[model samples]
Target chain A: MAVLLLADVNDGALATDAVAKALSAVKGLGEVHILVAGTSAAAAAEAAKLDGAAKVLHADDAAYDHGMAEATAALIVSLAGGYSHIAAAATAFSKNVLPRAAALLDVMVISDVTAVVDADTFERPIYAGNAIQTVKSSDAKKVLTVRTASFNAAATSGSAAVEKVSATADASLSKWVEDKVAASDRPELTSAGIVVSGGRGVGSQSDFALIEKLADKLGAAVGASRAAVDSGYAPNDWQVGQTGKVVAPTLYVAVGISGAIQHLAGMKDSKVIVAINKDEEAPIFQVADYGLVADLFNAVPEMIEKL
Target chain B: MKVLVPVKRVIDYNVKVRVKADGSGVDLANVKMSMNPFDEIAVEEAIRLKEKGIATEVVVVSIGVKQAQETLRTALAMGADRAILIEATADVHTDIEPLAVAKLLAGVVKEEAPGLVLCGKQAIDNDMNATGQMLSALLGWSQATFASELAIEGDTAKVTREVDGGLQTIAVKMPAIVTVDLRLNEPRYASLPNIMKAKAKPLAAKTPADYGVDVAPRLSVVKTVEPAGRKAGVKVGSIDELIAKLKDEAGVI
Candidate 1:
C-alpha cells in the first residue's frame, strides 16, 4: 500500500505542505514514494526527500518544462499501476491532470482532500469548505489531490536515493508553449496561515493599499473577492472564491466584503473568520467569528495604527 | 473561421450549497443553476471574436443533463450561432472527469473543425481547469490556458496569458485551444432582442455515445460532511484591544 505523491515542479517543487500532509495521513501504512516530473528533476528530488519520501523518482525532459497537464496526467497514470494510492497537491496542474488519469485507470479520484482516515478513506470539504465529507474508496486504486493548507507540512528531513525514470512523451498531445507566472513576493494564498481579503467595499485599487498595510502588519497573504477582482481593484490571482484559490488559513480577515456564496467557497475553511464591513446585514457576518460594522476608510487606518 | 466554445451548468454562484445528511454529496434540491461564470467569459470572448470579424461563426457545446440546455440558451442569447448539449447522467462536479469531457469535446472539434476553441479557465463547480488543456492534447493542437488577451492574425493566434508571476504572450497556430481567464473580458448580459433571437437559434441534443466517449464516474464520493464549525472569538471593544489580542494571543502581528 504505497502512497505515491506526484510532485508538480512549477510552483517551486511539490507543494511541500500538501505532500507532508498526505504523507502523514498514511505514514504508517507503507513507504512514501515521490514521482518528480519537470526540467529541474534535481530540485524536485531534493524537495521530495525533505518531505520524508523513501524514494524519489525523477523524470526529466524538455517536454516536462511547461508542465502540460494532459501529458503529466498520462505519465502519472502510466506509472500509477503499482501504487494503491496516488496523491498530488490540489494545484492547477493536479486539478487539471489527475482526474483524467484516474478515469483512464478506471478508478476513483478524490480531490481537495484535507485529511485521510486510513489508506482507503479520506476527508474533504464540500460546498466551498462550508461542509466536510468523509469518503471511502471501494475500488482497488484511489487517486487524490490534497489541499496543502489543511494540515501541517511534514518536516522530516532525510536524504533519499534518487532514481531516474524514463517517462514516454506524448507528441500527439498539445505541449505548453509558455507559462506566465504571476510574480509575487508574498506567500501563496492557498498555503498561507493568515489571509486578509478585500471586497467591493474597498472602493478603488488605491484603497487596497490599506488592506495591504493591514496584511503586512499581520504578516498575512492578501486576497480579494471576485467582485473586487472583476471590478479591477485587485489582480485575478488575489481573487478568492469558487473561481479562485481555496484557502484554509488559521485566520481570515475580510474587509468590506459582502460575502457572496462564491466568495465564501474559497475562504470559508479558515479556523477563525473576522469580517469588517459597514453593512450590518452583510452575509459575511453570518460566518464571521468577529464582525465589525464600520467604515473601512476609518477602520482600516485605525486597525493599522493599533497594530 | 469558426469558433467553438464549451460551457457548463453548475450550481449558481450565488446559491449556498448544503451537503446531504447521508454523506453522499451536496444537496441540490431547489438550488439555482447557472452557466458557469468562466464559461460565460468564454462564450463572450468567442462572440466578441465573431463580432470583430476574426471568427465567422460561433458554436456552443455543453455536457450534462437536459437542463444544461438552459445554460446553452443563455449562451445562445449572448450570441452563439448554434448550441449542442451532450447529455450525461453522472454528477457534473464529483463524477465525470475532465479527460472524458475533453475526449468528447475532441470528437466535436474533429466534426466541427473550428479554427479556434475557447473555454473558461476552469469550471467553478469542480474547479478542475482541465478540459481545455486535455482537449488541446487530444486534438494535438497548441493551447493557451488562462488567457487574458487574444488576437488572431492570419493562420496564427497571439494570446496573452496570466500566470502566477506575470503576463506572458505566446503565439499558437490556428486550430488552437484557449482558456479564458476572469480578466479576459466582462461578459455582456443578454438583451431582450437577443433573448428573443435565442429562442429561434438552432440547438441540437446529443449523447456521450454520439461523441464516442464513455461518460463514467472516475471519482467516487465517499461521503459529504460539514466543515469544522468556527467558534466565535472575543470581540474587542477598541482597536488597541484587537491589536493586543492579535499580537499576544494569536501572535499574528
Candidate 2:
C-alpha cells in the first residue's frame, strides 16, 4: 500500500514547506511516492527529494501547462489504481485538482487534514478552524489534502528515484492565461516563519511600506488586514482573515491591526503572537502573547533598529 | 444566454456554531439559517447579468430539507426567474458529498442546458470549494474559479480570478462554469414587494434520487473537539520586554 503525494511547484521549483509538510503528515502511511505533474517539472523533480518520499513520479506535458484542474485530475485518476491513498497540500492547486480526482474515483475527499488518525481516518478543521472533527473514510481509496501550516516540513535528505511518466490522456477543458503575480522579495506569507501584518491604521499604501521595512529586517512576510486590502493599501493576497489565507507561522507580528474575529480566525493558531497598536482596547491584544500599546509609526522603526 | 446558479442553505454567518457535547456535530436546533454568503454573491452576479440584458433568464436551485424551499424563495426574491428544490433528508448521517452534489447538479444542467453556470466557490459551512470544479469535470466544460470580475461577449467570457498572490485573467468560451469570489459584487437585499412577489413565483421540488444520485456521505465523523483556545495575554511595558519574550520564551525569533 503506497501513498502518492502531489508536490506543489512554481517556476520549476517545489513549494519548500507545503510538499514536505504534507509528506511529513503522510509519513506513517507507507512508502510515499510523489507526483510532480506540470509543464516544466525538471527543476521541481530535482528538488522534490524530501526525506519522507521514496519515489518521485514526474509527468510533464503541455496539457498540464496551465495547471488546469481537469487535466490534472484526469492524470491522477489514471494513476490512482497503483496507490492505496492519494494526497496533496491544501493549497490553491490541490483545492482545485483533488476534488475532481476524488469525484472521478466516486468517493468523498477528506479535505485539509490536520492529523492522520489512521490509514482511513483523519482530523480536519470545520467552521473555519473553530472546531476540529475526526472523520473516517469508508471509500476503498482515500484522497486527502493536508493543511501545510499544521505540520512541520520534512527534511530534504532522501535519495528518491525520479521516474518520468506520460500524460494519461487529453483532458484539456481550460486554456492558459496570464498570471499577474505581485513581485515581492520577502518570504511567502503562508510558509513564512514570521509575518508582520498591517491594517487600516497603516493609513495609506505608501505608509504601508513601513511594515515592509520592519518585516525585511526580520526576514518576515508582509501581510495585510482585510481593511487594508479593501482600501487598496495592499494586494488582496496580503489579506489574512477567515475570508483570506489562514496562516499558523511560528511568530506573527500584528502592526496596526485591530483583530476582528474573522482576522483572528486566520492567525490565532500562531505560536507567538505580538500586537502593536496605539489602541489598548484593540481586539488583537487579547490574543497576543505580547501586546504593546504604541503607535506603529514610532514603534516599528524603533523595533527595526533594535533588530 | 440562460444562467443557472446553485445555492445552499447554511447557518447564518452571525450565529456562533457550538459543537455538541457528545462529539456528534455542531448543534443547529432553532438556529437561524440563511443562504450561503458566497451563493448570494453568485445569485447577485447572475441577476446583474440579467439586468444588463446579457442573460435572458436566471434559474436558482438548492438542495436540502423542506426548509431549503425558503432559501429558494429568497433567491427568487433576489431576482432569480425560477427555482428548483432538490430535496435531501436532513440528518446527522445524511449529508451529500461534493461529488454527489456535483452529479445532482449535472442532472439539472442536462435538463436546463444553460449557456452559463454561475455558482459560489464554496459554501461557508463545509468550505469544500469543490462543486464548480467537480461539475465542470463531469460536464467537460471550461471552469473559472474564484472569479472576482466577469464579462461575457457573444461566445467568450473574460474572467479575472483572485489567485493567491494577486489576480489572473482568463478567457473561456460560452457554456462555462464560473465560481464567484467575495469581491465579485455585494448582493442586494430583497425589497418588500419582491419578497411578496416571490411567494407567488413557481417553485418546483425534486429529490436527489430523482437525479439518480445518492446523497449518503462517503466519510463518517468519528469525533469532534473544540479547537484549543489562546489565553488572554499581557501588555509589554517596553520594546525590550517584547523582544525578550519572543527570543527567550517563545524562541520564535
What TM-scores do the predictions have?
0.87, 0.95
Segments of candidate 1 deviating more than 4 angstroms: A11-15, A25-30, A99-109, A117-121, A130-141, A167-185, B20-23, B90-100, B153-155, B165-174, B231-234, B248-252
- Cα deviation of B103 in candidate 2 (Å)? 1.7
TM-score of model 2 relative to the true fold? 0.95
Q: Cα lDDT for residue A123, model 2?
A: 94
List, residue by residue over A2-59, the lDDT tens digit for candidate 2: 9988877665667768888999999899889898877665645554568878888888
Clashes of each: 16, 0
lDDT of 2 at A153: 86
| Highest-DockQ candidate | 2
User: How does each model score on lDDT?
Assistant: 0.77, 0.85
* CAPRI grade, predicted model 1: acceptable
Question: What are the DockQ scores of the candidates, in order?
Answer: 0.35, 0.68
For candidate 2 chain B, the 10 contiguous residues with the lowest summed lDDT are B89-98
lDDT, model 1, position A44? 68
- Chain A TM-scores, one per candidate? 0.91, 0.95
